[model samples]
Target chain A: MDLLPQLTQYAFSGLSTGAIYALIGLGFAIIYNSTGIINFAQGEFVMLGGVLTHFFLMVLKFPLVVSMAVAILVATAIGVAFERLTIRPLKRPTPLSMVIITIGGSIFIRGVAMLIWGKDTHSLPPFSGNEPLVIAGATVMPQHLWIFGLTLLVIAANKYFFYYTISGKAMRACSYNRTAASLVGIDVRRMVFLSFAISSAMGAMAGIIIAPLTMTAYDVGVMLGLKGFCAAIIGGMSSGFGTVLGGLLLGLLESLGAGLISSGYKDAIAFIILLLILFIRPQGLFSKAQTERV
Target chain B: MKRFVFSCSLFVLILTCSALCGASQPIKIGALFSVTGPPSFLGEPERNAAQMVADSINKSGGIKGRQVQLISYDTGGDATKAVQLANRLIKDDKVVAIIGPSTTGETMAVMPVVEKAGVPLISCAAGRKITEPVNRWVFKTAQNDNLAVAKIYEYLQKKKLNRVALLTVSDGFGSSGREQLKAQAATHGISVLYDETYGPKDTDMTAQLTKIRGTQAQALICWGTNPGPAVVARNAKQLGLKMPLFMSHGVSSKKFIELAGDAAEGVMLPSGKVIVADVLPDSDPQKKWLMAFVKEYQKLHKVEGDHFGGHAWDAMMLLKGALEKGDDLPATIAANLEKSRAFHGIGGSFTYTPVDHAGLAKDAFVLVEVKNRDWVLVK
Candidate 1:
């Protein structure tokens, strides 16, 4: 059999899933860069967005757009609140403690979600049409286009915010030197909280956008979180653009692996790439090599 | 000291009052289902079906004036959690009998607890080992993987598909199916052309399918839940392999259709009778009740009922019928179930004996094909 068409199909599938991973990974990058603490509950924020939206739209019979807006706003508020309560308390504490705290926070959120939502998988209406668009012998869902376009828009907006906005520069200064930024009268704490809000919103937005394709459930957050974390690490954890690239690469690799090789080992391909990257570069694709100052 | 004594007395009084109120209450049955994990697709439906059955029986004045109360716990598809849930249900909830810890892994995990507590436990999913070495307290409403294998073998023999390739998940369900298929294929003189296995959440099977393609196997038999069968369907189509594809009943879901798209069409599987409720003859013994159940379930849930839901309905109804027949709770229910014969159920006519806990025969399943992304009778 010809491999070109197969390869193309794999690429299309990869790109579709990659778009979602990039959005989630970008959320991870934002939190990591700002606070230097990985927000493990990022995926739960996404789940909360999709689930709340589903509840409002499907159960409460609210208008779809209204529900979507409410879900994003609510999820973002939750993110900010979580940081204020959990992460803020551990600001002066050890990094390991903060990491463990975030993990615990993730589990707590997931547990609460289970109790509230009753552990049912739910999906929202696709933002675009449901028809598959066949391009050059490869067929992809129209929703895939929506996800990819949304990912690009989010990335552009994020770039603009970080490079142009005053708060963004303050946030970047805090990331560079928290003590110095605090000395300069930059509200480092507020920046940290803002980072969480932005990251959580990104995650929630990813969930809302991709829920139509992958569906959403309480437990789905774990897998999404893990994949997004992998994407962040692979792309150079501090770089937003690198995170997106890494996510797309990882998604493409997994899909192509499934298409060309054994589908069963599709997930395995991600780790394998991870291992190879760590062995070869250690500093990640876009991360600068650090030298210890004497 | 007088105040402390008065507080203690009040606490005791409240406890006694609550205990007395609970003692005069309905017969409670605890159900542990994997309602929040990978298996939620199956467990959630089973829970709903169990609740539906309980509601129906209660609406009819329940079993001989005692209401059947179902207490459910989410196992999260973890074996350890299944045991924990089972203990909590038995101890805290004080349920007479437990209806499920759905999958075989979870059932086996909690089997010891049920056996030790001497409580009757009926599982909804199949793993033959659960009942085989004989745990008197442990029974199942669903047929074993071996029976499904036997049914598939019977069809393969009829279709003259002598050469077969196996693609299964490397888990309890897949391993059980693989072993059964291997032994049965040998007995039926069917050649084992190729065999491949994959992890549970795998989304591709091209490599295995390619190996099977080389073998020229007349049929490809896939065993796993959800995406396993979907991956097989998609990969098989991509490779242009025209062999007849057969799957284990685990993949009998709308999720498979949604995942596999048009590639799922023409895939054959040995499905439980409940899947084709409309195709059953009007004169069939359980037709009216089954149809009513389907209508009610669809009306309430807004989704088509699956074999999992049907099995739960049958199990709960059987238990209800047994409870209604006798005064004693556990003993009478067990005896009534043992003596039951040709009881018309959504899964077809069931006959339970002390030895056979499943209460259904191989004939309860009919071979079905995916036609236009929906299950259709093979005939």
Candidate 2:
């Protein structure tokens, strides 16, 4: 009946969006850390998850669960292929060239998707149902819950992989010291490829979960990718925890700013905060400043 | 002497045949639309509708014994690209006239180029600015944003809904629409209690709607094309806002209904007769034209034609009429178009004067509502 419920409603909405951004940020962090390339196609993998799933569910008449898993797998394969076809063949490129290749790859992927699925926006019905459950007078759709739950699961899984599993640890080591890790027989290139595959899988999962709320279209990857990349940079490009925090903060700030100030200024508000953070906390909020070896 | 005479006769026959082929060369119409970007819902239909009109006209016997040749380029809703394509159409393809450069942004962007090139450009975009300044080379078939605003206010006055909130996108189309909305608000006795603008690519607009909910507005008018307006409808229903919702002509498509789902029910918008083709009286001038277009468009695209498509149909039909009335020269064709009067097309009867290049009347729009997820004529 008052401001509290409204604020809570905005907060819930913010959290749901934050979950998607976190997933995207997590993808950005993994790829950026491992290969030092900001994979612009990271968002496209997420986009492919939704676009391919929509195609499967609507056109192919595939069952929901199968379509989803297949979408994720398809996106993962595309990400792996992106590395193989675009990244690997460049034989010894300058860092800027690699970044440009990813950008080109993103544009190419988008154009292909546009051809397959025309530029109109397509939507999937919410998983379970569309009805909202009221909590403390704030309406929350079941899809929001799905997004939140999946995001936490992804984060926990990534933590376990990086901390406890050998493959993830090797990938982390490659990011930390590629030359040293290669000397210690880490197979740095293989780790880089694995990181791309893993992060792409995460992005695909995010797309699938969020597609029900935010409809999918061919050109959605560009802006969403930019936001995720911003979140990653703000969260400390190297720290997974910081990336998640950054994504959530960006989402919350954007939502609250929109609600309180103006929707027109919401994007500007987020970017200004990012710029301020970049200027002040260049090493990122939660990241430890690692000194470069001379 | 016999061999030389035979060669001279053969060369004369070849020259005559070459002249005949050149006479029947089709009129080139440059077509530009977003086709593959955010606003493709508007551009794709315009592209398809223009092509359909061209194909049917040629089939019914070529215009002036010449087929219509359409050289279409996908602008992807980018203004800079539209300008480049316009130049290419003028310089490279050498189209006699340009039909579209879909969104208002692209239309405005390419206006100067088309004007400077001295080529006729009949835009499928609805920004009033296209024709207001009256560029000698530019014309438009899309109803002016102000005319659409007037149509909405006419319905609102009848309903006695005075206080309204306006939410528009921050693109050229929305900005221009906002100007009309504000400029005409006082004239219509509609007090805009809350005004808001949103990003074109934004997926959600609940924050703006929430702020509007706090106002004493009797109705809400959300002006945007495709996904943005659809999102507003969904968000309004999600928040259970009690105020009646209205939309601009931009969301006059089945795509909006599909995206908004149940949320689209009872939401009104001012659109053309394309959606209500079956319901129109047989004697109505627009009926036959609308029926023919709907049949051809549905047959081709496997979807219903919206107002965006109608805009293209009108523009192409106008250009076709001009081409038919005048010679292939661009200046003559532009003059013939300026002389258009009582030419009934899909949108409405058009009358163009030297001062007014856009031919459609203010009554071009009809108020329609999404009832049971279908476009229903509002009585």
Candidate 3:
């Protein structure tokens, strides 16, 4: 059989999944850009958002809208508190130490989540019905549309905040040069915390939207977080827009691989692509070429 | 000097009390299952059933006038964790016997530990390897894939479905079933038209199903756990491929219906007759036991118990029966289990011999079809 149609189907599936990866990648990008440290707990933020929403809406019988709002708010507060307590104290520590701290934070958060929610897979009702919409002999779930649309909206909002808003510009300045930003009267520490808060909120939003599609469990965050980190790295970890692009590409690759090849190797394809990209173009697909600094 | 004497006297008294308590203590059985991880669906149900059996047995004055205490640990579906838990249960908890570390991988990992400890282990999982290469202490209560596959072949032969396409998950359970089907297909004079494989977490199977649709197979044989069967049913409906679908007993759970929805209709699979029979003939010895278990389980859990729960109940009952007869808890339990003959269980009448640990016959399963979203006996 000709592989074209199969490849196309794979592409459609990949794009849907890639949209989710991009959202997660963008969250990583936002936090890394501001804090100069990878927030390993970013995926757990997504998991927390989804699981908390499930508890509030389904188990507690709260209205869906109210539960979602509360989930986001709680996730944002946690993001801020995490930065203020764990990350803020490690400001003067080595970058390696900060990275290790974030990893530790991720483990701690996952443990607490497991203890609180137990390890059952929890799912919420899809925002739309579960019917798959067919287009050109390919079917896509309605929830995939939500994931893609939300990714776009968040990206646009992030762009406007960073480029147009004064607070956003201050954060940007701090990312570029902390000493210069501080000299110019920007509160560098507060900006760092704000970046974490925003990034965490985005991560949580991604979790809430995708939870209905994939279901959520305590340990689900580890893989998602790793994949999102890979996406960010492949897209140039410093560039938020590039991270989104990288995530979409990774998602499409995975889906196509599952369709044409073995479904068992679907996850492996992403890491293979990641390794190849790093070997050939270490600067990433969209990042500016930079000389090594001594 | 007076204070020291008083403390010494208190210590001696505590030691004496503990020794007395230990001498007349209840029998402790270690139960391990995956309370966390992916297989929690199977493991959680097994755990609940095990606890229910233990509670019921104790309420009935336990085995031969001594209470039975169950100490359970979560294996998390990890082999390493299974070993650690088995060690803890044997060495630390000092349980006389152990029930499970459900799944083939975990069971195999903990087999050496249980064997070394000289404790009898009766597993609830269905991997035949647990009983083979034969450790004297290890016995499985659930029917292995060989029997399940043979039943499938029998059903297909009876229906005159000579041409079949197979789709299976590429996991240990799926691969084992596939091997059995392939081996038995020629014996039954059935033609294998097509074969496809998918992973456990796969959400879509349209591509595989589409390929299978082109084949002139009379029926589709799917081998996997929950979402796999559900996905197949949904995709088959979407492709408008109308043919009988046969599944292994692994998919025999209520969650299959919840996941598959309307697509679950007309799907036939093998299930233990004790669980599927709406009205058992009064002549059958297991009828009362099955009904009582069904009623109590439903009353307490507010949900119908499946073959998994029934299997757990049978395993516990076997242990109870053994404990009642055996003078030395471990050695006697093992001997009694081996000598078990015509024990009426919720699954079927079981008779364990030295060669076979799973005492029930392949005929114990009745072909069941989902009609109007409820299981109906087909044979």
TM-score per candidate, chains pooled: 0.80, 0.91, 0.87
lDDT (10s digit) by residue, model 3, range B74-114: 99899899999899998899888899877888988888898
Model 2 lDDT, residue A88, Cα: 84
lDDT of 2 by residue, A1-294 (tens): 367767887787677677678778889888877777878888888889889899999999999899999998999999999998888888785679999999899999999998888777888888978666777766667888888788778778877888798888887777777889999999988987898899888888888888877889887787778788878877888445678788888888888888888888988977897788789987677776743200
Model 3, residue A30: C-alpha shift (Å): 1.3
Q: What is the Cα root-mean-square deviation between model 1 and the actual structure?
A: 5.0
Better of 2 and 3 by DockQ: 2
Q: Is candidate 1 or candidate 3 better by DockQ?
A: 3
Q: After superposition, how far is residue A207 of candidate 2 from its true place, in Å?
A: 0.6
Going through the candidates in order, their DockQ values are: 0.15, 0.55, 0.25
**Per-residue alpha-carbon lDDT of model 3 for A37-110, expressed as tens digits?**
78899999989889889889978899988999899999899888888889887647667888898899889889
The i-RMS of every model, in angstroms, reads 5.3, 2.0, 3.6
Q: Among these predicted structures, which one has the highest lDDT?
A: 2
Return the lDDT, model 3, position A8.
Answer: 56
Which parts of model 3 are misplaced by more than 4 Å?
Answer: A1-5, A238-241, A291-294, B1-15, B21-25, B34-44, B71-96, B113-118, B156-167, B189-222, B226-248, B260-287, B298-309, B364-374
